[model samples]
Target: MDLNRVVIVGASLAGLRAAETLRNEGFDGEVVVVGAEPHRPYDRPPLSKKLLAGEWEPDRIHLRQPDTFDDLDVEWRFGVAGAGLDPSAGILHLTNGTDITYDGCIIATGAACRRLPEQSRYSHVHEVRTLDDAMRLRAEIADGGRHVVVIGAGFIGLEVAATARQLGNDVTVLEGAPAPLIRGLGEEMGAAIGAMHEARGVTLRCGVQVDRLHDDGVLLAGEDGAEGELIEADIVVVGIGVVPATAWLGDSGLQLRDGVVCDETLNALDVDGSVVPGVYAAGDVLRWPNPLFAEEMRVEHWTNAAEQGAAAAKNLLAAAGRGAGAPEAYAPVPFFWSDQFDIRIQFLGRASADDAVEVVLGSTQPNEDGTVKFLALYRTGDRVHGALGVNAPRWVMKMRGQLMEQASWHDALAHAATLA
Candidate 1:
């Protein structure tokens, strides 16, 4: 297939970067970016942090320079989403009653925030996924007298809780798990995080279930009782999680599990495990095998999306026989960071709940300033699997390189002992 045009669906970080990479890789073919949101690509991390706190304006979160789109030489189809894909015919149907034929297509639609079932019926219910969500949340919580309730204690929810507290509002964090962030960071670290919020005056209800959402508040249930307590809330923020935005591809013949299933090369695969030529996926919408972990995972970090977008672009060129040689497999040592209150939490590599966590430096003990600083190594058997650093950037930076080198558990522990 002669490469004449490449259409990138989803005009966010991944899509924009992929378009820039294609042009850089010497693919002068026509490029098009389609987005459901009317705005151009903007940074998302701030939506939960600075934007939610009202520390930064909406215009400050843009992913690119003001003149970037004008120079990209690509057609922009904003406010219209990709409704369907006819992969066999190499055509993409748009929500605006238009179709685009392409030699290559990159799926970067990303993910949407998961909302509670009762959200639609309540005007005060919100989820922080887009800029508008943050703007509304920030405005709603600006009044210090409002009682803000945050459902879920994940990064986003915790960030919102912190910001709401900063705005002088009474905040309560509801987590069904035994501890905050237990599903992601395990019990020890999750408890440490819970302590941080507690010190900041954010009430945490852990190991409790929210039975239902009322017009004014939520009904809670403890371990033994079905209707336990009612917490009054003027504003409710749901940060349960997100699901991949792949509903449009239901009949597109591509494998869709949690995300768009791709092979090691980031090329979309069919139901038979065969490559679906001319179709690739990147960002949070992509599930590709990482050689480093020997497992297929979809990463939602900002860094992962940038790296995968560029990798997908190169692979797209190579797949079309328009590049120098075979493309490299998309394998990256995953890393992500979160800032809550005064602590900066950084993580590198992967670690499951069963992995052994050994704190090598500082302490998870709360300080006078409601901060906990620590550096921990996560390992299973003799291999170092992951590392977590709280308020310890230098340690995380060094361990990241060590993780990429696949440092042995013994050597990593020895090095970590020095930091202790």
Candidate 2:
């Protein structure tokens, strides 16, 4: 196997980490990282929290500095995207009419924020995903105590609301669902987040549909009937969710079902088997098979991208016989955290599909400083599949190890008793 010419698409968390991991794993090959964004790879997690709160600037979120890429000897190709792929020729077709041949290829193309309906001025509607988006959002919100209408009650929306509130502005969250994060966290757990927002002086309006965005405010129509109420907000932030960035690979022969489909090894599932021999995928774009749940899953967390990128790098090296041993499979516990209005909400594992649940730690007010809540321990008969913790970072971080090691629920319960 020749260790030469590895091309990576999307200079995101996954793409940057993949490049770094390749160099770290002793891959002295020709590495090229292509990004659609003009700027280098940056941390997106803080965009909604610290950056919006005016605590951190846009440039501060950059993960790797200018000199770092040069030090890594990476051929940085910014402001260009991989338009097409010729698998037989082993060439990546760039949008700007540039072609690059590669021995191995990595598709770390991440997701993009789903846009809202068309408006007169698109600048009024904001979505946080990149440094530019965050900067623009922060600038609008910094105009001193202006009302902000946030659509969706997900982590991003809630975080933006928290930031707006911290800046002495009135914030209202309009969630189409009955409760916030009902799909992600079950009704019971999501209600806890809603309760936290209510206690923090943020108005939570559930089961309300946005008719349309007007000059004054959003028209509402739902169980409460149609009301053309003017909430009076300077800007509207929509955090409904994101769609995987894989439309460019439409001609690449890789299976795309809501996202790029991949095997447990992260190899792209090609139609002809030899379509993209050495091509692989990672991060939110790759709907890879998970061993723990025995199902193909797609994770859209920040950590997932970084970790999977490293794993994909190792797998690529293994395919080239440069790795020390067989690369382990990518199976994250699907945990993520959010900091909003002095509340740090954290989850250990996937709480999306839990049927039954129990409050293991704190029932209502678990901790004196803040609310510590842990939800339904996942189990198959008697064995625990995973554990989820809400508003408990230390607990979630601690349980992550247990989830990875397949620690028993009985022991977890025994340990929960000690925390009480």
Candidate 3:
């Protein structure tokens, strides 16, 4: 296989990292990156925290320095989206009416924010997916007197609520589930998060159905048909979830479920289960089977994206006969962190709803200073599945290492007990 040219779609964190990896691995081919967003690759995590809080400027969120591309000798096609893909011909069509032929391609298009149903009519409705989104929402609450209504109790929703509260706004969070983040962190941990928000003056309206979003506010009704209340607010931010940015590949003949389906090697697969040669995917847009967990999953986190990007690039090189050995599988222990009020929540590894959960250290109960710290471990029988820590960064970091090593449930529990 000859590697003359390489095209990377979606100039995101994953795409940027992939490009860097290709060059570092001695691939002197023509590397081109295509991005829909005009801005250079930036960090998305701070968009909700420091960026929204006005603590960091937009330029500060960039993943690399401004002259990074020049140093890497890469060409960037910014502000133009990928329209279609002709894999058989090794050609990529862009929205700007330009097409490029490539010997290898990396699909790192990422994901887009899931918008609320019928939210277009309301001008105050917002989402925090991009830098523009954070800027707009930050401007709305700049005066700090607005009544902010955040729909959903997930990480994004809760982070917005916390930031709004910090700005002196009245915040109310609405969640359809009985507790916040029930699906992600389970009921016990979700309730703990809900209580933390309530203690910080944010209203928690859980298990309620939102009827509609009006210009004035949100109309909500109880799930059991009980009469509901109209919560008035000056702004509403929806943080429900996100969908993969795979719409452009609708006719690309690639497999798609919730994301671009791939094998363990991060190679995009066709509908017939055959590999789409020279094409690969990473980041939130990728759905691959994780060998460590023995389950197929799509991890939408920074750590996974960075690790997968490098892995995908190496595999691309392997396919081109540049790699030293066979392509390696991407198997990473997923990790994520969130900042709400004064608490820093971090989780390591994966866990299902049926996994057994136990609080191993500290307590979720607020102390006299309103600070909460704790460590909880999740297990299935004798195998450790996951671990969560609030305001315990050191312990969480240690636990992350243990999770990476696949520590047994009994040993992890004993180690956590010692920490407690």
Candidate 4:
């Protein structure tokens, strides 16, 4: 338990939070953060909205102020990535040909945006991921009259489409799935949300095959899966989701399925399913079992990254301190929100085996504030497992607590009755 220096990789939201928690927990030992990007820790959500829309400058999205960041008093090794790891030996290999020995290590490398096959051949293609990617895309879409075709109807793609349309550009969103955001909101609700965008003038093309990218537009697979019609576009943005940033951990001796598999306490697990002490993972690069939901979950939302990063750090320190109680277990309801155009979409909980989403409040129609003022409860058997709210923050917050408590279906209906 002789913990001294703690090394944090990936300088992302999760990594920054972990470092902050280590310092806050009175760990005065050396704290070193190695990041792939040259910039300091910065907020990412606004990259697709404010920054991509050209409404805000690059400096506006920094996660911390200059002086506040300096106050953390940690050695920052930016523009260098973690190349390898040796948890048993407590060594982290960096891409810059340097090895750092630490008493504790936390991996928060996050995820990278996934691109379509052969997408790089086209110079006009873009992605909404890092700050630099957003800046490059902003220049192409800022003029507003360009035809912007977004591949993938996920949050990032939809958000970019909304921003482009609001800036007076023609936007088209193509989703290979039956409905937009089907992975996140299910087909029914996702269709409803997609319709809202369609009503507001963004072209929504669902259940189609993207043959390949042409220099001028996207070519669709025509009849019999051959070359189809051409959707002309001046620019193309690929938001087809992301893959965990686990390339550096390929030979790190940790388990990597879809992401870094972890136990209930967020400690990284080895290939044989044993917790590798003093090593943890957070953000999109982590997958852990959630005792509350009785399901294995991997969340890619901001809230999860922030909470899990701190939780991992606390548990690591607790393990090191050999504290009074066992290392604290991380279990909580997942939550996420997305702002598109004038709508505020918030969701709590997750998709369970049962697809019973009951509309508990309001209508799908836009309210006076230009929001779809509605609340939907995800229930099955006798328990309410999740809830989705559109511009209904109070209801979402209340249900978030209830979902954490594992409220009954009847209780969820009772709450909705109160809203009625």
Clashes of each: 0, 0, 0, 0
Q: What residue runs in model 1 are displaced by over 4 Å at the alpha carbon?
A: 222-225, 367-370, 418-420
Please identify model 2 stretches exceeding 4 Å from their true place. Answer: 119-121, 222-232, 272-275, 366-385, 405-408
TM of each candidate vs. truth: 0.97, 0.92, 0.97, 0.97
Model 3 segments more than 4 A misplaced? 222-228
Candidate 2, residue 342: the lDDT equals 60
lDDT of each: 0.88, 0.79, 0.90, 0.89
**How many backbone collisions does model 1 have?**
0
In model 2, state the lDDT of residue 46: 93
Q: How far is candidate 3 from the true structure (C-alpha RMSD, Å)?
A: 1.5
Write candidate 3's Cα lDDT for 29-137 as tens digits. Answer: 8999999998999999988889999989998998989777689999998999999998889999999898999999999999998876787777899999999999999
- Model 2 gets an lDDT of 0.79
Worst 10 residues of 2 by lDDT: 375-384
Q: Positional deviation of 361 in candidate 4, in angstroms?
A: 0.6
For model 4, which pairs clash?
none
lDDT of predicted model 3? 0.90
